[model samples]
Structure formats: structure tokens, C-alpha cells
Target: MKGKKILFILSGSIACFKACEVVSALIKNGAEVQTCATKNALNFIGEATLEGLTHKKVYHEMFESGSYLKHIELNSWAELTLLCPATANIINKIAAGIADDFASTLLAANDYKKPFLIAPAMNVNLYLNPATAESIEKLKKRGVVFIGPETGLLACGVKAIGKMSEPAEILKAVKEVL
Candidate 1:
């Protein structure tokens, strides 16, 4: 999509580093990208790298200067919102309707009419949790799309189904949504 605007919302997960590759691939494929990292996500990837790649300011806080309504602005600017390496914590927050952080706020303010994709990455225990399962179903019913928590070795040193999908796979999913 030449003029499509894709907003990548990264959450705290070891897979956050892979998002850089995702951004690069998206830009190379002719999609405009805007990246915003959750507070915990910043712990893995720096804002400087995100800003440098997208050539757009990376938002992490609601009270950051230069915008009185960053969430609304970002929501309006995005054609599709994609949350890569979506953490179990962030997923729960979104499912519970929490909007305390910039990423969560944007997600909360997003219109369901637009495409919303989430790629979860967590331990197998968390992935298999009943709560997480229910939340996934609820989000699906609400029209949210999921990329993958592909089966593989996890950050916790366990072999299971909680790894983030490969960047190519995620990019393909994005294309399908767009």
C-alpha cells in the first residue's frame, strides 16, 4: 500500500528488538510507518532507534511535550494499528479497558472499524492461561486480529508456543489486513 499508514505499537517483550526489522521491512515495502513504544517496551528498544527508523517522533508518554492530544492524533493518523510482540501484561490491560499509558490510550481510543492486529509473546504458562485464552477470544469477537505466538523456544528458556512470529510472517499478516 503506497499511501497506507501503519502504526506499530510495541510492548515490553524480548521480541521488541525484532520490531526494528519489522519497521525496516514495512518501510521498504512502501508503507509509511509510525512507531510508539510502551513504557516497558522502551526497556528493550530505545526511542532513538525507533524515531530514526520511522523519521517520526516516537511517543511513550501521554504528557510528552509538543502535543496536547497525542493519542487522538496518532489514532487519526493510522490506517491500521499493529501491536508486535504484544506482552501478556499489555494484552490484559487492553482487555480490561485500561488506558494509563500512551500505547494503551491509543488502543482504547481506536475505532473498532479499523484493523487492529496483535502479536503476542509471552511464556507458555501465560499463553495457556485461561484468562489469556478468554481475552484472545473476546478481542477476536471485538474484531481484533492476531498474527502469532508461534511455537518455539521462549525467552524464559522454555520450549513452547509463546515466541513472536517471524518478521516476514508478521509483515504478511499486515499486508493481508491492509
Candidate 2:
């Protein structure tokens, strides 16, 4: 994955902190990472932390002055797009073609021929919900790849699936892809 361009999307999930480790690993592997975050994501991991790591600004709005096309530009700029700590909300939005927010809109603009991946992180019940499950299936059918939401303890303190894959594993997956 040396010198690859990765557009990383962060959604609202406690796993955002863990996803930061993946971002760091991507940089160490010589990949240039640009982050796009959701408003709720910043509630868990600050924008400054993402900006500091990537050395690029964190885009969380669709209508930033002088960069109204930022979301489309980001999609075109990336060789691969990965959404880590993907919450059920974001997943469903992508599946349903909802792009009301910057993060979701950027995802909607993803180039289908390019590698697009999502690593889901949410409560087990939410993960297992019919709506979320259907959304995942829809995305998979549309050629979007999904990484692990491993079975383990969750932020809510219950042991089950819907845990985002660990940083090392996520990095390995990214390496294998590009």
C-alpha cells in the first residue's frame, strides 16, 4: 500500500478511537490518508486529532466555502475509500441513497470501480437488525466490500459481534487491497 491514496470516513461510533490507530498505520505504510468525518464522530474523536494525524483538514460539511466540490474531489482523488467505525445509521444511509450530510454524500459519490470498503461498528442488536442487515447485503451486491465486525465485547459492555476490526487487521486488509 505504499504511496496509495486512501480516503477514510469516520462515522459515529466509540470505535472511532481505535480507528485512529488504523489511520496511523496507513500513514506508516506510506499511504496518504484524508479523513472525512460525521458530526457525531467528532463527539468521540476530535477533529484536531484527525487533522493532526493526516496533516489535512477533516471534511465534515458538504458546503464548505471555496470547496463545495470537496466531496466529489475527495472521491476522485482516492485510490480506495474505507469507512471505519461505520455506524448503522451511515450504513443504512448509503444503502438507501441518503446523502444529507458530508460524510454520507461523499460515500454516495464513491466510484464503483474503485475499492470501497466498510468496517461496521455498532451494537450487536443494531448490527443484527433487519434494516441494517438488508443494507449490508445491498451494498455488497453493489460491489462494496465489507471488513470484519468481529464478535467481541462492545462499547455498551455486551459481548457479541459488531466490533470494528482491530487496527492491525484493518491495516492488513488495506494492504491486501491496494
Cα misplacement distance, residue 77 of candidate 1 (Å): 1.2
Candidate 1: segments with Cα more than 4 A from true spot: none
Report the number of clashing residue pairs per model. 0, 0
C-alpha lDDT score of every prediction, in listed order: 0.89, 0.93
Q: Write the per-residue lDDT of candidate 1 for residues 72-143, one digit (tens) a residue.
A: 988898999999889888888788889987898888888878899999999999988888888888899899
Quickly count the clashes in candidate 2: 0
| TM-score (C-alpha, index-matched) for candidate 2 | 0.98
Best by lDDT: 2
lDDT of 2 by residue, 1-178 (tens): 7789999999999999999999999998899999999999999999999999999999997787866999889988999999998999999999999989999999988868999989999999999999999999999999988998999999898999999999988888888888
